[model samples]
Target: MKPTEQIESTLDHVNMYSTPSDLKITDIRFTDIYGAPMHCSLMKIYTNSELVGFGEVRDAASKTYALMVKDRILGENPCNIDKIFRRIKQFGWHGRQSGGVCGIEVALWDIAGKAYGIPVYQMLGGKFRDKIRMYCDTDIDPHLSGVEAGQRVKQRLEKGYTLVKFDLGIGLLADVEGALCAPLGFLDQMKAYPPEVLFHSRATDEASRALRNKVYDLHNIAHPFTGIRITEKGLDYLEQYAAEVRSAVGYHVPLAIDHIGHIGVEDCIKLAQRLDKYTFAWLEDLVPWQYTDQYVHISRACQTPICTGEDIYLKENFLPLLQSRGVSVIHPDILTCGGILECKKIGDLAQDYEVAMAIHMAESPIACMAAVHTAAATENFLALEFHSEDVPWWSDLVCGLPHPIVQQGYIAVPDTPGLGIKALNDDVIAEHIHPGIPGQWEATEAWNNEWSHDRLWS
Candidate 1:
């Protein structure tokens, strides 16, 4: 073939939507959505080509995390995702701190996908599955009994969810006498406070600062350090709860449990032993993700599978748990665990150690779709979490996908360009915009000039 003919053929197939080589990032802006059950900050990275990529900060995380690094990425090509990710990743740390870096990385991928005219999963070396399995996370009223909880699980099953999770911890025993034995004032401090009081207590006044510090001190106490113990009577009640839930849901489906409270490892082991007969999918976050030794201890003590890692940040930090064979399942929240590619890498690494991977997602559709892409590309994938099944407007926040994203407990991997979202539903979003966060994707010129020497070494 002649060179001229080859050039002409290439031109025929050129993407009219984007000039990948010339796609420079113009700005980064955010809109916070409330009552997706939690406040989720949705990020949009605009490009010179007029294409916008969607990403999301972890639920309840501040948008400032993403805004702080805007200057570092301006004028850079969004297609160079890895190079850009390396530049900003240093700014991210574990937990919600990583939300900024992770969210931006996902947006970059979204742009790259649009530029290349393919789905994000295709760019991640193609997909391993056509549809991503979803696990419904149902949090019933804590005052409800185990039987009621089981009924909730039954509802999820009726909706076609093969895998389901529920909250099963000391929170259930909060009102029950003789259920929990803790240090003086600990239970009182942990009790739920009114929303107005809790919000006002975050003020900068001296009194508010002292009160906030006191609450933090109590909450930050490591699991083992807390002198909370569950008595035999408490154990019996919890066991009965599990029994009723299991009986209602039946043994055919996989049932997972979470939020077992801030109790120590001994209590976790006792509860795990007691509930082993019901055969739970896994006992999640028994202690904390940072306590690799505690997870190892719990895994060894119980027949039930142990799981953790939603609060974990990068894949490197997961090394301790993976190396020690601490947990049977590694649950990475896409937003917290360094976004789409990083979660896929975590899943790949977990597969090396024969560990299953279930994602922990409780954010907007932006983050949900990011997890869906990551799950589609990962080989050790289990199920992605669906936390907003009850939120009627949850799936309406974005367009270009099915009205009900989770059809029969699974989301079909989208083949459309970018994160499969054509555009954000401004009307639906307007209705749910977080009243406290003042603007809706307003111009962020202030962040454009905020500069710092980001280098870590001399």
Candidate 2:
């Protein structure tokens, strides 16, 4: 070949971005954004090269979860994703506790994709579909009647969501007489505090923390053990609500139900059977996810599909649910289920059991793109949950994606490398910083030297 042609060929093989082999972790930082419906902590893993990868802790989780492990990964190559994940996975547990290890794992994939100049899905294997179907989660005002709730959900259908979900349970029956039959003070306790304060919020003060802890004690009681039961009056009220919703949206659209409150297994079965006439997409989290036997009983007793696992941490934990066919659909939030690769593994495992997979995403745009990549790669994938469709600035948090990211009930998977995010919208992010913990990607220098023995075995 000619000298000029040889020079051009050598340049073609060069990556102008960064030297992938030499990339090392330099620092980690985070910024918290509140009221994109829930508080979310966004993290960035910096490397020696100019590349930075974005990740998000699960909604309502603390960034301290990620920071505590910074020293374990300092100076390690970000491209060694699985090795780093194995090194750090021992720190993660179920639910929001897994947020740190999972978020960091996502950042590693983002870095790996940028280094290889390919999309995350391509690295996973390849795309199964170019666009992912989205299921809108509509949480209307609790004061609204069932008819009013139906009208609210109908608005989402008009906005182009083919699949939808709504909250329906004993919580809605708090005001109605003879609707619920729990212990003497249990009913009063639920009525005294709003569900947000009782379940969602991170306590800011001593009094609030005590109140939250008290509520948590009551709320954490297992379903069968809670002594909470729905009365026939409650069943009638809930049934009527479902009828109104089904009538408003018509039977054509796929409608799902969630947050049925902490009622017992018998109450769960009763409610599921009562709502069977409405033909819901699924009865989600009817009982705690750990009670596989209860789930099996509920599934066997009802026509509506049973779904759970949004708070489950890893693939191994999901096996019993899948193996027993406890639920028809396995819904896993990528942020809670050990990040992109682990979510894909869960989907693959579910596929082996012949159950479908739907992702449960409630975090920021960073995690959304991580889910998008995973959904595109999984063969048994179903729709993904979009919790912030009503948040105007939700789409403004990230760049390099289409405006109004969810177009007519589906998100077009991006071909761009590294979760398809060019950069975060600093201005938009700054406007929504958490009021209690205000900052924008401040240096986490304290976490740099937090060393300890993390090994699980002798």
Candidate 3:
């Protein structure tokens, strides 16, 4: 339980990496493939040895996010995972940008697992559960008729998801009076954005407000600044949708709600209190997790459980929230939040505070496998997220997985080495590459030469 145990492991732990301390990272390259919700990227770290390791960056992020760390990790022993993580952890930050370090960490662990002939969970510690319980997520059209909503609940029930989440955003109030200030004020900024982001932007006008509207750049937006207020009338309208969904799903299942929009803490608290009758699994990301005080206020004010941390990076950043009991549950995205061991570390820390840990995942199979390993090892883990249950090709993204990747709402913890995925189906990836993005993975030789001194502390 000491910090040394996490960063430094004993020889008795797994004994897989002991034999291959000589394997060094020869090259690191990535492939971009389209996935549910957004385009996803992954790291393919080639070592001096033939055993390769694969890791995924969070969905909707750039592949270059991981490639930026190539200079730091090159020539390092891939098997010395924690030591390599320490050398490059300085390059990581608190959001999706941290994907670089996370991708590298997962890959290093994978390589070590393969080199040492063990599974990742064995290296982490030992398993707590044989299978990880998955919570399924899907979007809703608030305008659906009663019959339609009921039909949806029945369909999802047939699919065998025990825990469910629906998008509970301001869009539910679109046709109501004075419900939304500007519904489509910002439209798909992912396409309109420039090549690079600035530390300071001069877009204080009413027009350059997509970030304020919470339509884009979700990684950086602070919720309080949005000034998006919901009137009591709007609240009542939103509550109608909640009541309908709750009635359909019933209390027996853990029906969670999320994406309430960029509103102030006061509105968030009011809504949480108002919706207390429904008894949600958790109300997620009322704002970013950085506002620990507001989170504590919301946590104390409501009967419904509060959840956050899909955008948080490492265990150190989550400690403040855990110490303050700011939220009842810590939800981390596996690819964005420092991969397998780091998430296990966060889960362990949360256990100390009696806060439950659930993962926030929306990527290809590679990242989900990593999450499965972490969730399997963490005793206090509640659920791992499933965002692409509706995407038809999601399972085919990776080959050699058991058919029906998730069976009856649970994923069997794979017993094979590394993440247990045999390989990415190159043809499936080829079919799904987003337009204008590079379609090939082998052309990243140029990235190997792209280097700079990015060390932050002197």
Better of 1 and 2 by TM-score: 2
Ranking under TM-score, best-scoring first? 2, 1, 3
Best by lDDT: 2
Tens-digit lDDT track of model 1 for 287-369 = 98999998899999989999999999889999899999899999999888888889989999999999999999998889999
Name the weakest run of 10 consecutive residues (lDDT summed) in model 3.
193-202
Q: Which ten residues in a row have the lowest lDDT in candidate 2?
A: 194-203
**Model 1 lDDT-worst window of ten:** 193-202
Which regions of candidate 1 are displaced past 4 Å? 1-14, 192-214
Clashing pairs in 2: none
Model 3 residue 456 CA deviation (Å) reads: 4.4
Residues 342-406 of candidate 2 have per-residue lDDT tens digits of 99999999999999999999878899999999999999999999999989999999999999889
Sort the predicted structures by lDDT, highest score first: 2, 1, 3
Off by over 4 Å in 2: 1-15, 198-205
Q: lDDT for every model?
A: 0.88, 0.90, 0.79
* Model 2 Cα shift for residue 288 (angstroms): 0.8
As a whole number from 0 to 100, the lDDT of residue 186 in candidate 2 is: 77
Error of 3 at 251 (Å): 1.3
